[model samples]
Target: MGQQQDDEDREFDIKWADGAEHKEPSARARMLAARWKENPPGPVPFRGEPEGVGPRWSSWVSTAVVLGSVVAVIVLLGYVNFRAPY
Candidate 1:
C-alpha cells in the first residue's frame, strides 16, 4: 500500500515540446500585436471610490420601509384569514 501511494505521488517525466522550428508571425499579426505594447492587459486600477464609501443612511431607511410594508401586509392577510367564516 505504501509503494502504491509512492507511485501515485511520483511525477511522470513527460516530453511535451516537439522539435519544431519557430516561424515568424505575419505582418498583419505583428501590427495587431503592437497595440498591447502601449497598454498591456492586466488588473484594472482602482480609480473609483471604495465600495459603500458614502453615507448609507438612505439605503437603510429604504430597506426598513420595504420590510415594514411587507410585515404590515402579512399581518393584514393573517387577520383577514382569521376572521373568515368557514
Candidate 2:
C-alpha cells in the first residue's frame, strides 16, 4: 500500500528544468483571441452624467458661494484702503 501511494505521488510531481520548450495557447485562449479579433474592444465608455439628468443645484450653489466670497473680499479691501488716514 505504501509503495502504491508513493507511485501515485510521483505521478503528480512535476520536474522543472531550464530551457523548457514553449507550448501553444490552450483551445480556450485561441477561441477568446479569435472572438476579440472579430469584435475588438473599444475604449471604456465614458461614465459621464446620465442622459436626461442635468447638473445638480448644489453644484451651482457652491459656485455662487465661492464667487460671492471673492467679491466680498475685494469690496472690503477697497473700503478699508479708502478709509485709511494717510
Candidate 3:
C-alpha cells in the first residue's frame, strides 16, 4: 500500500524548470474591460442545479412536493366543478 501511494505521489509531482518567466495578463484584462465598457454583460446565466452534489433526500423531497401539488390542484378543481351544478 505504501508503494502504491508513493507511485501515486510521483505521478502528481510537479517538476519546474529553471528561469521560466510567468507572463502577465494585463493585455487581455484591458481588452475585456474595454469590451465590457462598450457592451456590459447581461444577467448571469442560470446553470441549473449541479448534478450529483446535494443530499439524496432533498431531490426526492422536491419531486414528491411537486407531484403532490399537481394532484392537489386536480382534486380541488374536480371538487369545485362537481359542486358547480352545471
**Which model scores highest in lDDT?**
2
Per-residue lDDT tens digits for candidate 2, residues 32-84, read 89999999887776786788998777988999999999999999999999999
Residue pairs in collision within model 3: none
Worst window of 10 by summed lDDT in candidate 1:
11-20
Between candidates 1 and 3, name the one with more favorable lDDT: 3
List RMSD in Å for every model shown. Answer: 12.9, 7.6, 13.8
Residues 1-86 of candidate 1: C-alpha lDDT, one tens digit per residue: 99987765553312222233575788987876897787677777778557879855788899999999999999999999999998
Clashes of each: 0, 0, 0
Which window of ten consecutive residues has the lowest lDDT sum in model 3? 11-20
By TM-score: ranked, best first: 2, 3, 1
Model 2 local distance difference test score: 0.83
lDDT of 3 by residue, 1-52 (tens): 9999998777665333223467446898989999999999888658756678
Which parts of model 3 have CA positions greater than 4 angstroms off? 1-57
Question: For model 1, what is the C-alpha lDDT against the true structure?
Answer: 0.76
